[model samples]
Target: MMVSYHHKNSGQFEDICVADLDYAFTNVTLPDREGRWCVGVAEGKIVEIVEGDRLNAQHVWHLDGKLLTPGLVDAHTHIDKAFTAESLGDVFAQSGLASAIQAVRHLKSQFTIADIKQRATQALQWSIAAGTTAIRTNVEADAFVELRAVEGLLDVQRSLSDQIDIQLVAFPQEGWFAIPETLESGASTYVEQALQHGIKVIGGNVNQGLWSSNPEAQVDALFDLALRYNCDLDLHLDNWDSAEAFTLPYVAQKTIEHHYQGRVAVSHIASLIHVSDSQAQVAIELLKQAEISVTVLPTRIKLTRVAELLEAGLNVVCGTDNLRDPFIRYGDADLLKALFLLAQLTGYMANRDLERLWQTISNNAAKMLRLPYGINVGNLADLVVFDAYSIPEAILHQATRLAVFKSGKLVAGTMQDQVLSLHKPDFMSPRRWT
Candidate 1:
């Protein structure tokens, strides 16, 4: 959309600026701001954000005093295994994470590229409707699946590039070195093969299905692949409830040793909560120094040390880990719901805490994925308009997303009509008791 603007001059007219914006959002309340503002977008980038509804463009959306924020980011998910819980049955639900991991094997072997795309597309649609525009999904990349998950998710990534940014992590769910048959054949490991096949992130699971007695060796091998591929590392460390399952400190140490600081993310470090406070602090310090991103799957783990991590001024984000899968068997892929649950679990009731916690799903996740995100000038116009006036209000209620904008285009939204109040408070009328 384009808008023609005329410049006023002394006695003569001049075309100082054309003001060819693709679209503009007016009458929207920005986070922490007092008054309504207008955001102008041109060529898929925000061009201006000025107070008051003065932006003139060919297409203008009046948000009706709703809140506007950067699009939500779901930093961690399992799209390859989404929506397969009932087939696997409720047995894993009773047994726990390990059993769930084992139960999914039967389903994983049957996953075709088309099947993965179909399930992933459904999950992505739910997430998009929930205002998430960026996601990072861990795709299984061991010899058993033989890069089928990677291949399938890459297809989904390409197909949904316009709606959402899908970052694929070549995840060796069954340990990078567990499958001897693939190694005996002298072929490259599936993780490396996946990276070569266009996955820019490497994933490791040390606590689950890891055949290697040397957990540190898996970490080393993952780092080797990450360095070899020149990609980011997202590893699952300390995922269980026991303090003895601790591997986060080692991962942090290796992150710094390999100079992978600020390029590595560790998910589900639940052991941090079980360890002594001093020990947890020591690990947190290493994480801070390494500049590692910590992602907690609030739906999957109850004790992830998110409060302490956030207090340490570390980069902490949250994700919807599994949707109707054996691992979780719940969640609608709504990241706001996950963040709300996180806020409640962490007792983040204060206004400041709630506002800051919103970053976990938006800015912090974007930082983890290294995306240029925000409702700032010159940044991609990926934003969500909420049916509320404040961050805390939105999180507290999981407010409806009025509209979602990706690259300055309207992609998904609940175009509900403006709410009407049929009954008015009759203050002048006497109360029955009175």
Candidate 2:
């Protein structure tokens, strides 16, 4: 089928051809549909979605029997530190978080703009090939590294602007007030410089300043900067394994006090699992009232009560916090792998449970990041087509993507086969082939 529409860029009428839209999966939760469906694209936006057999257009793609869904969105990641496992040797084996922080600080000292850009671009390519269309990464900005991470990510963002959407958070891994240089130079100045360099979000580590004289003061200062700069907040709070480390309630209170509801997100609050059930409920209520979202990193921490958090009406999302860095030694820039691990850790085995888990990496993460693409008409044509029959089968097999589209244009996919063939005697035991 072919459809005619005006192209947004050329200011001219054009015809788009779509064929065999039958066997399409409209929604992840809905059952498959057999009726033919055609999607019309104009000016990089989905103009119309038709459910009929007779349609016409200039370009036609017959999916045959592929499963289509909204492209994956990674709500949280550390792209700057990706693929650095080989350099650390055995340091990560005996070191804790504190030691890891020190090691990262050392690594940052030697970071040049070219080096950072090369590594970050490599990570983005891996993500794009994995069917991820949008990513929100936290880049470090402190006295040691200054704006190196921010500048490098901005470069990568420009280079891949046509392939994927990248949102960078100017993160002060060291506390805003704990470091003497930051205090002397004024933390706002550092963050403002990062914002000027194209950072869209602001991030902080609440636990970094908790040991200082007054932790609330640091929190207030960070929130004030975010409000003043008109940037969203994504803070790392209460990451300890102790029950008494309760910064979530205070963060919630501050969110309401500053009128920053729905604009604030807290990550790695693993201590919520250690608190008593009643206390945890109270904290969850506070988070709900404040309209604050949560990002859980299952690989970095062991106790993340994802099931309970979801039941409390909180917008719980998942992220690959670190990849082959000091914080974590393993990650392949794949959010589906993260979702699978999260399901196993949280004991979500049922079909319905798996559907909900899928939402965390796709729709839920997209909403939190304020992206425009999804499985709907009149949205950006960013989507992924999988070579599977059902959502469950896709998750179970984790097969390679058939096609990845960004703004109605093909970006990444596997088109050629790479199989090796060798002959062997049939009498040989198959079990001993290895």
Candidate 3:
């Protein structure tokens, strides 16, 4: 599936100028722009992005109309949880609660570690199909049973790096406080080990499983550990329909108070939807102040809505947390669906601001995950082109991630042999663009 000839550039052409796209996007991190241009790429570095016809060189490509932008980075995720959720029965169904209860009740003899791996691989494939280049995955870690689950996700992360970038977080789904056992060998310590081995963040869950003292306390403990290690904090906060969850001002408050330098993110927190209007406004203000980021799994969060979060201008990011497991039944992994849904639900497309909420999946996500070179010159040439002529069209249709390039090399394309094929490309994994 070589990209269409339109994406190629002949250095000899007058319209083509070669340099890094970074120069073109100093203000905006990702070059989500449209124009007639050709980007000369080499050694995975974008040598230039300049107006030109096309390069006529052995290693040159001429790209036109299509915008060359940075690969997407997911702000928050639970790699294993998402992978396993898809197979664990459909939580979105009306009888979801009963089904999950039954599944858990019958889970004693039927499940094996290999099963988790299978589910994770399935989910990773879905993400690759959707153009997600990186993710901050929460893994199971706490006592031995759940810890084993997280560890298994860690293995999956390693296995799928060529297609997706993963930041494994050793997360304690159960409480660290009540899971008194965790105090002895808590997930944070495991986080230390995981980080040394490439895990990027420290993660925790509040009001669930072990040590259910206070939600804030759980997050604080994880934040403290993160600060100690100089790592990022990714917490799964109140994920229910209970307004009583987290008391007054939840994730946003802590994020601002802590003023933590490293990344601090809250995943789910659907309970925030139930927060009071006045309080929600305050939380949103605080969140912007702290620069705290969020990840919203549309397929999962749609099960519940934190309307206040949406109203507070805290646009929930679209993520496909679960692939094909218990929590989720089917998985599309296409963010365009999620983004379109978000725009419709939150009125994100009311004005030119369509690009505003668009950040939920693109630029905002990049900031949350802390990728300095996600899409820049002198970096891996990972990029995605869409079937949109204008920004508004891109948002209205939530456009297609029609083409994918790795190392300035097209790996997937909608069209055949042309610089960019306009046809919808096949969602094939490990594809080499001809």
My TM-score estimates for the predictions, one after another, are 0.88, 0.85, 0.75
Which structure among the candidates has the greatest lDDT?
1
- Highest TM-score model number: 1
How does model 1 fare in lDDT? 0.80
Off by over 4 Å in 2: 1-36, 52-54, 95-97, 179-189, 208-213, 415-434
Residues 162-258, model 3: lDDT tens digits: 6677777777654465444233234555555656665667776664322337666766677677767778787776676777674325556666677
By TM-score, how accurate is candidate 2? Answer: 0.85
Q: Ten-residue segment with the worst summed lDDT in candidate 2?
A: 22-31
lDDT (C-alpha, whole model) for all candidates: 0.80, 0.73, 0.57
Instruction: Evaluate model 1: give its TM-score.
Output: 0.88
Tens digit of lDDT per residue, candidate 2, span 57-153?
4555554334567788999999987877777755756796557656767888788888889989998888988899999998988767788888888
Candidate 3's C-alpha runs over 4 A off are 1-34, 59-64, 81-102, 105-114, 144-147, 179-198, 208-212, 247-257, 301-316, 373-376, 398-400, 414-416, 419-434
Candidate 2 global CA lDDT score: 0.73
Arrange candidates, best lDDT first: 1, 2, 3
- Give me candidate 3's TM-score against the actual structure: 0.75
